[model samples]
Target chain A: MTPFELIVREHGPTVLRVCRAVLTAHDAKDAWSETFLSALQAYPRLGADANIEAWLVTIAKRKAIDVIRTRARTPVPVGDVPDGASELGIPDDERGEVWALIGALPDKQRKCVAYHYLVGLPHSEVAAIVGGTTDAARRAAADGVAALRRAYATIPGGTA
Target chain B: MTNIEAPNTADLDRLHDRLVHAADEAGLLDLAYRTVDTPIGRLLLAATDRGVVRVAFETEGHDRVLGDLAARVSPRILNTPKRLDTLARELDEYFAGQRLGFDVPIDFALSRGFRRDVLGHLAVIPYGTTESYAQVAVATGNPRAVRAVGTACATNPLPIVIPCHRVVRTDGSLGGYLGGLHVKRTLLDLEAAA
Candidate 1:
């Protein structure tokens, strides 16, 4: 595999997760598509010393923020919390299951989880990105994890 | 995993591994690329080690696509060529009417808020049939926001994967499609013929 492709395979999931955290499943696709499209254009100039995954994630975060900005005029309800029973016919996987729990999180907590745990951003880095203090970012991430664990606990052997 | 005060490097690594596996464990393991001759044009198909990642129509040139792979796969662009193989297989099956649904893994990280809500609802559209924007709004419990639903469909990235083509106008006319109406008609027709 080429050096570029190898890096993407290893780090792409984090970027994807970060995007998913900030955006919805469908919108995440567009944001992800756009982020990558731009990345492709900028790759040749990216410095070798740059943390490629973090750089791409920074772009994805910016793109997701743009999506939120452009669409903020409308405040559509997030709808009722999804129950596993409603999605019974769908295939079950860690992605779907984790996504379901992730969806249940409030937006800020969700983003905190995405930027911190998923993207490997430290609290300080996450704080800077979200425009808050490090402790706030850390707390949000903690809350998100706790909520996810609680939600999944009912799944029987989900996780303690 | 108790007393997880902070997500240390190991926590991040494990979460990343689990997130990637979320797709694989979902059974989306085919990756290949194929140039499919469709009614619209030569479509660019990209798959993963499991399923298709992208299906671009009338989209050509290497640099742009390579760049797309770079963003989606990120530092992992090398595996994109292999991912194309999976895209080829899935697209071939989709066009041939042999596939009912896509088992692809999509990264929906870019969208949030309203657009996300609209697109997420759009994914529930079953193959072949279509729904009006108003219906989608109503189904999503935002019955007053048909126009928002339209905007959502317009911005869908994984159009085929999310089945945004299935979202139509209340008058039963094709609205707008980011992938173009021609592709939408072809997708609708493909499902109808089945």
Candidate 2:
């Protein structure tokens, strides 16, 4: 088995991106931590030929859901939640604008887009995580990206 | 879109720090390691929660050592340097000739049986001195196990910290060093100069 450190180094950023795309920044960090912790615990027994990226993405998806479920139980004051950019602590950048756009996408579309586009998993794999047929996953990601394109076109001085 | 870039380097670094903290808190960081540039070479220092466990030279192939650690200790390892901060400082002090001995905690979980016992006796070999394999074997209460003593010193998991470089052949020749004969001579020369 490869050293667990190599696993973290190789896949950490992609997993973080997937987590951030699916959840808030604060919650994304929590999800990322939990995902790797769980992965480390089960890593030794992982087969040599296992798809490490997919395995980590699958774990990250579950951890993201856990964070979402926990957030559902917490009471929030009305109008207290900040927009995606400020909440992610990168308010001034265009990347923040992009994140805000992704965050606004419907849940299934956002997850599909994240799994398929951000990290480059196939729609079939995205479906395995988000639960739908491969065809559905592909459609959701396409629709999500289409919506982003439309929104980006409307931003003043925005380049494609 | 095109702006959906990879997270910035600072962001990834912060996330990694958070992950290391969380892993440490959750007791999942079974082995933490960092490399220290030494007069001899870059040494890979690794620790368990118990204490510093393995100190490897670059010549030993750091990747190979980490693989052995994963197989022998636990695979739940990470490159979290905080755990080895004290040990690294101690190593710096020792190499700079400001310190004679390490006061840091050590986990000898990697060494076993007579090897472990032989390692225990190594610490008392003192600075700026050398002991024959026969002398060490006698000290470990197995005078005839001279070869075993040599083996122990050769396989010393914590080399410089444990002072395995202080051991020599009965003929007053440097028998062998896992770090290489040149490194052995360098260490001996360093201590002798100090």
Candidate 3:
């Protein structure tokens, strides 16, 4: 088996991107840590032909949900802004603007875009994670991108 | 989106640092490693939470060493260098002729049985001095296990730290070193000069 360190180095950035797409930046860091720690614990048993990136994305999905659930249980103070707003702590750069747009997408569309576009997983794999048909995943991702294009065009000096 | 780039390199590095810290705090990081440039060559140093576990030379193939560690120990390894700072500093001192012995804790989990005993005895051999394999075998309480002693030195997991270079053939020839014979000679010459 290849060393786990190689696994972390090879896939860590992609995994972080996926986490950020699914959750807030603060929560994404936690989910990334939990995903790799859990992956490391089970790495020895992973099959030689396993799709490592997809496997890690699957784990990240579960950890993101865990973080979301934990956040749900906590009481938000009155007048507190919800996540994915202009206060996500992302800098006002082109990349940050793009991430904010992706974050504002509907839940299904956000995950579909993340898994298919960001992580390069197939619609079938995306469906397996999000619990939908392959065609539905494809449509969600396509619709999400089209919506982003329309929204991005209205911003002054925005280049899609 | 087509224009979307992966998170910048600096962001990823910060996230990885946080992940390493969290994994260590949660008792999930079983092995941590880093490479150090030395007078001899770049060396790969690895450790478990117990202590320093493996020290490998570039000639030994760092990738191959990591693979062995994954199979024999745990696969939960990362390239987090903080844990090896003390060991690295001491190595720098040793290579600079300012340190005689290493005081870092060692985990001899890789070697066992008679081999482990022989490695333990290797540390007792004083610097700038050489012990024939027969002498080491006798020191380890088995005079006839000279060949076994040679095997131990050949397979010493933590080579320089354990002082396996101090062992030689009874005829005074350098028998063998896990790091090449040239490296063996270099280390011996360094200590002798100091």
Ranking by DockQ: 2, 3, 1
lDDT tens digits, residues B51-156, model 1? 4455555544534665665565543333333345554567678888998787667656545788788877777778889999999999888999989888888766
Candidate 1: TM-score of chain A is: 0.77
Query: Please, what are the lDDT tens digits per residue for candidate 2 over residues A1-160?
Result: 7889999889998998898887877788788888988998889789989999999999998898888888896411122346543665244445776776788788888889989998999999889888979999999999999988998787777665
Clashes of each: 37, 0, 0
Pairs of residues clashing in candidate 2 = none
Candidate 3 global lDDT:
0.87
Off by more than 4 A, model 1: A1-45, A48-160, B1-39, B46-53, B59-76
Give Cα distance to truth, residue B26, candidate 2, Å. 2.2
Which candidate comes out best when scored by TM-score? 3
The local distance difference test score of model 2 is: 0.87
Per-residue accuracy of model 1 over A25-101 as CA lDDT, tens digit each: 55665666567556655665688688776788888988888887887973222435356443311233334556656
Estimate every model's Cα lDDT from 0 to 1: 0.65, 0.87, 0.87
Docking class of 1: incorrect
Kindly indicate the candidate among 2 and 3 with the higher DockQ.
2
| Predicted complex 2: DockQ | 0.61
Instruction: Give the per-residue lDDT digits (tens) of candidate 3, residues B1-194.
Output: 68776666777788778778878998888899999999889999999999999999999999999999989998888888999999999999999999999998899999999999999889889989999999999999999998899889988999999999999998999999989999999999999999
lDDT of 3 by residue, A31-126 (tens): 888898889878878998999999999999999989888889641111233555643325533566677677778889989998999899999999
